[model samples]
Target chain A: MVSLYFLLFYINILLIGCVLVYIYKLRKLIGFQLGMTISMVAGGFFAFTSGIIFIYVYPFHFLPVTIAATLLGMAVGSIFGSFFDYQTLLSGYSNGLMMGMMSPMVGAVAKNSFLFLSFAECLFFASLLLVLSSARQT
Target chain B: MILYLYTMLGINILIPAVLFLTMKKKRKLFTDRYGMTISFSASLIFSLSLGTALFFTLPVSFSVLIFISAAAGSIIGLSYGILITFQSLIIGLFNGTIGSLMGTMLAAVIIDPSLCGLPSQFSTLLDRNIILITLFLTLLSLLSSLLLRFSYRV
Candidate 1:
């Protein structure tokens, strides 16, 4: 049943959330609540976006939607990167992997170079946002 | 066709995973209430603009009625995206850009599957299946968020 899939999906999400919370608590012990918050907010944002995309965007094969999502992530990541003590290099790496995974999807659906480029732009912008945020913080 | 589905599915998984990983490393970064709020708001606005753009671009027609409907649908989608994004932001929650993008794309795929110039048979099937899958994934994300909220309650 479709509801079953939905149930599984939610269960996985809950588990992930719990883990993140646990990690946040651990990080809190070290006075890194800021980092934890950033990560939580980012995760929340991702989950929200994923839901929206599933409900609306992919059916039509819109390129801008992906671009916008990537841009938002970059913005969030950049903010986190700027103020936190840790380097966002890892964030960048993760984003890159995501971007790589996404390219083929966009290509398959939209087949537009502009869409692909937008995804790339999002990653670059996210990296920039992180760096800028870090600079501003320091 | 399968490639497209797999890629979309992969993105669905990866976006959340990456966000979770990022948060696991730095939850405090989100505590800046102002910044998170702003980012969330911006994402909502971005989603609206994208939805609007999609509504207008697809369903290309030489006919007046079709054009009018397309324009109207674009407006509706844009408004809906904004509404949903804003609601989600208020709760100190967020989804990644990819998810938003996917939402818009899913809309387009449904409204204008032929726009991509795919073979009609494959695109149609893909479009329908994607809609189902996206729904499943969205539900999953919401459930996960709820779980996170409950589990993290101190």
Candidate 2:
């Protein structure tokens, strides 16, 4: 069961990586405002999912989980934000940081509910899809 | 350990205060968009970090922590927004409040992980974890302030 959850976590990460690459390729077409929105959604969504999945996996190591999630959020936000402008970067970074810090706690609260986890994963996928579609339109 | 936490909190407060003062010195030079960004990010980061620190440093008093943090966040936002326009002020106020609320919630969970149904740790481990998080948040606050300062160049 734990392995299954771990696999799901990695798959989500892989999907995020793919999205990042796609966004990078389309960086030229997106406007500054859209870029900030894209980066914020990506960073916050990924951080929230990863944080939840991680906490659900290892219910013990709270400290490390929080640290990892926060860093992950910061890294994703900055990378995505860097594609646009300094203000975009700042917006993404702060949003990601805030979400990252809050996520593991939310995961912890959800406890052993696989249903909630699945819903979170689905939301992430749906949001990513929206981001890609919007980017393509741009 | 309590003393150490208080010291960290003071440092956390000071970093942003310095940043706010430095930014204040040049409010006349800021462009409109830049002013908004500064107001938004500064207040958000300030409220979040301070809220977390207060929750961790004080005793387990959720009501007090929440009230203080929310007020602190709104004030920070208002201060930054006051430098700009009505729109920026509103943005600052909302973001600051949300950010502080989040920080308080996170701190609550950290202090008592059992709130999430996970088995809680021993006191020593919990203290150590609190210290580590505090240090990490301080570093984050510093990095963000540095980023804000460098925005002038970019």
Candidate 3:
């Protein structure tokens, strides 16, 4: 059977990616091509870091760290929202950091399998963003 | 024990996250203080753990792992937002290589793992002064990397 945690994690990632893409679409800051690329590349980093941060701050002292991580995520998100129009790497890193702050990390394995899974999340987000943006443009 | 394992898990996940973030080509962040701080912390954490692991495993595979970690760390450090100087890359690379060797020694004593290499060879390598010096250098390298920002962009 598929791991329940894995399912939740992917679904969470997909929902966040789509919502953010929609917001970006409304902002009218980034072009379709750049948005797709950023979502794909930035999404992977964002997911993996989210998983790592989740692993670090879960179960114990979750409240304090979660709050702090939330602030950090907002900082990251704000940075990205401001700079997406200009196309900057710092903005992407901050966005990745934000996404990392928001994701849940299931304490299942310590292997690198999660790395590939995170990339898959990125690709999934990228394609979905591409489709959504393309639809809106047309 | 659990902390180390958590950190191991954390680093494995964090490395790729940082790597993908660095793939973007921007001309501003790395040169800035905030960006450098993140890279410095990530490099130090990544190299130290891998280095520590190398000491215990002494497996040929660990060496390859060290190389990959170092490469990824440098790649991320050098390219994060703004292209950082070559000196920063060198500092990061140095941290990874030295950290691994030193970590090997520290782990041999702390975890005292029986694997990695011949007991006799390890014993000789783990001489008293070696431990002190390794500890000193590791700290020094970490501090210096964070403080110094050489401006040679690759």
lDDT of 1 by residue, B33-135 (tens): 3333323332333332333333334445435533443343333233322333444343322323433454455455445546555334454464555455344
Look at candidate 1 and tell me the lDDT of residue A23: 39
lDDT by residue (tens digit), candidate 3, A37-100: 4443444444554454454434332223433443444344444334343223333433343343
What Cα-based lDDT does every candidate model obtain? 0.39, 0.87, 0.43
Write down the worst ten-residue block by lDDT for model 3 chain A. Answer: A103-112
Best by lDDT: 2
Q: Report the error of model 2 at residue A102, Å.
A: 1.2
Model 3 pairs whose backbones collide: A50-A100, B30-B82, B51-B100, B55-B104, B85-B152, B86-B152
* Model 3, position B91: C-alpha lDDT score: 53
Q: Residue A27 in model 1: shift from native, Å?
A: 9.0
| TM-score of each model, paired residue for residue | 0.32, 0.95, 0.28
lDDT of 3 by residue, B70-121 (tens): 5544453444323455555555455445434443443443433233221233
True contacts kept of each: 0.03, 0.88, 0.00
> Clash pairs of candidate 2?
none
**Number of the predicted model whose TM-score against the real structure is largest:** 2
Tell me how far the alpha carbon of residue B133 in candidate 2 is from the true structure, in angstroms, after superposition.
1.3
Q: Runs in model 2 with CA error above 4 Å?
A: B59-61
Task: Name the DockQ score for candidate 1.
Answer: 0.06
Q: Which ten residues in a row have the lowest lDDT in candidate 2 chain A?
A: A103-112
TM-score of 2: 0.95
